[model samples]
Target: MKNLLIAFLFNFLCLCVQGATLDFAFQLGEKQEPRLDKLLPDVARQMAFSRDSKKLIAKGMGGTVVKWDLQSRQKREISRIHAKRWFVYSIGANQLLVRDADDNITILSLGSGDETLLTNGQYESGSLSAEGTLAVLSKGDNEVEVWQLAKQGPKAVKTLQTSFPVRNGLTLSDNGQFIAAAEGTYGDGEGHRTAIEVWNTINEHPIKVFNTGEILGVWNVLFSPDATMLAVDTQKNAQSGIRIWEVETGRQLLMKSGFEAYWTRALAFSPTSDSLASGGEGGNLRIWDISEGESVIWETYPTGIQSLAFSPNGEYLAAALWDTTIQILHWGTSHER
Candidate 1:
């Protein structure tokens, strides 16, 4: 069985390499582009665009967050922190969330220029729900906390306690109803065994626990827009793959070989929940048909993808890569692929 799986993976990878081709619409931060270079340095930690895909938000290595407009090409330093290790965790349409070296969560409003200190607790990873109403943060040692965002102040809604020390890779459902977290250890014996746990945000209870066995470690987990499916990336002996699970039935629908050099870093579902896009490690972008349970289409670029976002109309797919460039791919072209 293992040999067959290996052979299948090898053949799939070859096909992916041959089929992969990137048709770039535009590049965000190229040399001689003063607008992008002047806003911040190229070594930014994270870059995200607003929900409308009209503006771009990038976190500088020096603890600064800048917002740039795509139409006017204007840039503004939205917020900055003095902490050496501070990094922007997530950026929303109206607000931006940043985490300091000390694990402090700060919320900043783009319109009013107001900032709110959400949490003082230390966390290894953090993410905002799709609706921007809730924030999930990992505190290490099998503990995670959820904060409710409000106009007045942010409140701690619940704490998710796990069985063992958990590493990063946290994802929240689109409707803000569920959270899927990767639970495992790091270093030496790392990647040995990782489990994915889905929890209900309202009651703060574990809805389902999917054990990935002893060979693979969970790299990323994503919940479908309708909260119907959970996509998980698992790594085994340096090879990585993805599995899709039906939330309601608790059935694993698909397990397909993914990028071999790097585990899947980002997984995003389309607005209609009919397709999914994932990118990681080898600068490979894969679009999968949920109904087919296989990767029918894939694309590869020059740089490794760090993050991905689908437009509200689901017409454009924006990918943030390691080369400090954002590539916007038309959804129509992908559908035709």
Candidate 2:
């Protein structure tokens, strides 16, 4: 059975080749099979798997939140807050960081139904560290503030300023040692110039600046789990794609194109950091080899994909689809046979 699964994965990787075939295989072990978790009546737009990978938390379009038990295959509504827009960052062991429609950010306790307000005013965007220990908030002033979500309250650590206005993307490294934001501006005659800035949280100094010239916009920015690479989803006049950069040297590692920005904004790096997965509006999902920039692509659904996440143990890839469903695919990595 194991060998058959491995062979199936090998054929999956060899289904298409552009530059060169990847030398690795993403396997599906005998333990878990790829399955689709349906979200009926509620349409999920934001999602995050529990750190332990035992549960999945989803927020619907109308502000309904549900927690699904992976083992039992059951779901329960946790909390519901009506808002025009919402954000779900990280799901901790007992708490979740979320933002309501009015831009009120809070840490909600799953056990007691209690809420701890991190901030009350309006902010451009926010992100939480993987462990939920740190949070970063970006405001209109092009200043990104690092906050320590202490047990008592939230404390401002340091602020990192960007070169241009923060148009959209903002993310923090899991270790909370670094923060990244997308900076760009539209000029009268110079056109649109965009750049991604990474800052050291300790000294509030910019460590690396990736200048993406004349792009329409940068929609999302993410740091790899190991904090060694950064990925940005960019849209240009003629094409759109994702760009990856080496964190230490400020070097662009890869630029993968051919997908429309409107549909392919969701990106997630594998736990091993050797590959990446992206989902698109056309329900297309592509898993790309980081080094070679080749991918195994497939159409996941008929509707668009809104978000993507990987389990910490590298066992499952969860994608939130526009058709009101969360699809979880069992994934494992093994060396070339």
Candidate 3:
């Protein structure tokens, strides 16, 4: 009976290992390729698809923000607010948000071409919810505020503070309910520890924190479209690993590797939440199937990707390269892996 039980246990362990190592199946379509690249004016600082994925908001040279209609292929100049550098993103279909060099946040309306200043406080990095109703902004004081953007100006609904100052920016959920904040450094340097905190932005409370326990500083943190999973990456390209965590349970789902390259800090989740893409340092752009665990690489640019965005429909990907050009790749068609 002892020998029989040992055999059964061995078989069970083998099955578990097999299941864990299983690779996802991939199907890429033949003759389907990236459609074309669109070059834009000045240096592109930031690019983001409008909440509905219908339009794209970009901060071109001179701190000028432009909203491009994806379907019409036309450009509408939104704002040309001047500053040395700033953080700009689309608030929704009608408004655009720009945090200037002084850390002042301004809301721009595309239809009327009007600007509204948000005098909440001095903010460091920020993220907007999909609905444009909520915003999470990190301040220089190690405090994070969850703001209600849909109502009055920037009204602070919740505040989150960290023991350490933030290294990277913040990522908010679709409904503006959750926020992911990363703080720490990277590399083999001494005292290098990175931690990601997932907070309930709506309830104004803390959730789970992921302590990488490595000498790596996280560069980006993104939430899936459904907000069920979160992806974190560091500055170590070759040594960097994709840390995915379950939102509800606060449990890590998986760690994907082999993406190490030089300066791979830029990352964006597809609109479908089934894929991810990142670019930096090098002119190489890679697309990964989150579920299938495969990647399609593109090296069409002479420089690295400065910023990236997916169409609201997930049918296209727009990459602003360091070479001062924008490439809009046609996504959707699949091929055999």
Candidate 4:
């Protein structure tokens, strides 16, 4: 009987391990082939995949934005704004936001190519809400302003005042219910601390602030699919970790490595809200289990990872890297090994 009981325990442990291993099964999806040497020179600072994930919008070093089709593998130059440093800060299927060195925001319609000046004020960071209803722009030390995007143009809706100066990272929830702004620095500094401010657009008041002392600098923040949790990256102390916080309770549920010491450049929550994908320095891409606080999958390449996105069905993951290449990865079915 003692031997039988021991055997049962061993079998249980084996099953647990198998289940954990089956949680993440990764495969290669579509390959994005871009003519790096001929089409563009230097590195890509920002990239946005179209709403249907069929095309990509990339902004290179010289303020040039190009639209590339994945199916036909064709590339078209969208914008060649003559600025000291031009960047397409945000992109959507219908619209694109370009920022120049002079601190001007230009909203361009992809369909008509009509350009409109949204803001002339200098902004350190900015992001468009998932629904495209609001555009949040940050300026100077502690000022954040939200602009309402209408059919005509953008209008300032609300403004937030922060306690300290913020670096360039801002995220909006898909439902347009909350905005998570990263407030801090990347390297050694006295005010290097990570704080996530969750605010409601209706009330225009912050619901809660998740502060991580002075050792961590919030690099990026993302909301889960259901908008129930918040994921943020801390870059100070030569450490990078993702902390999951309950939106309602402001309680931290899990904290997982954000992939070595490299800064987490982009983060995306899976459609099912069961996992998260983060891309960062060292060309590393990592996926973590939301509930288990474990890294279920990871991949490394030659170029640094700049952005990441998960498919609507949660079956595929897409990454935009510094090597001027976009990669699509397939999530395999889970099974016992």
Of the two candidates 3 and 4, the one with more favorable TM-score, higher being better, is 4
Order of quality (lDDT): 2, 1, 4, 3
Tens-place lDDT digits, model 2, residues 152-214: 888887777778888767888877777888888988998888888888777757888899888
Enumerate residue pairs that collide in model 2. 263-280, 263-281
Query: 211-272, model 3: which lDDT tens digit per residue?
Result: 77653576668888788888876644345546677889977666655554544656787776
Q: Write the per-residue lDDT of candidate 1 for residues 199-276, one digit (tens) a residue.
A: 888765688887777645665677776889988776666766788889877898878774565577667777678777
The TM-score values for the models, in the order shown, are: 0.79, 0.82, 0.76, 0.78
Candidates' C-alpha lDDT: 0.66, 0.71, 0.63, 0.64
Model 1 TM-score relative to the real fold: 0.79
Ranking by TM-score: 2, 1, 4, 3
Candidate 2, position 48, lDDT: 70
Model 2's alpha-carbon lDDT is 0.71
In angstroms, the error of model 4 at 142 is 1.7
Per lDDT, the best of the predicted structures is 2
Worst 10 residues of 2 by lDDT: 25-34
Task: Point to the candidate with the largest TM-score.
Answer: 2
Give the better candidate number (2 or 4) by TM-score: 2
Residue lDDT tens for model 4, 1-337 = 5534542343233222213321222212233443434423434556656667666666665566777776676778876553223333233436776676676787777778878889786676666765567777776467678789887767998888775565646666767777777776445456555666777767666798888767556656678868899988766557666778999999888876535755787787777787777887666667777777777765555546766766564455667766555665655324412
Model 2 misplaced stretches (Cα beyond 4 Å): 1-41, 82-86, 91-94, 260-263
Model 1 misplacement above 4 A? 1-23, 31-47, 60-64, 73-75, 82-93, 186-191, 333-337
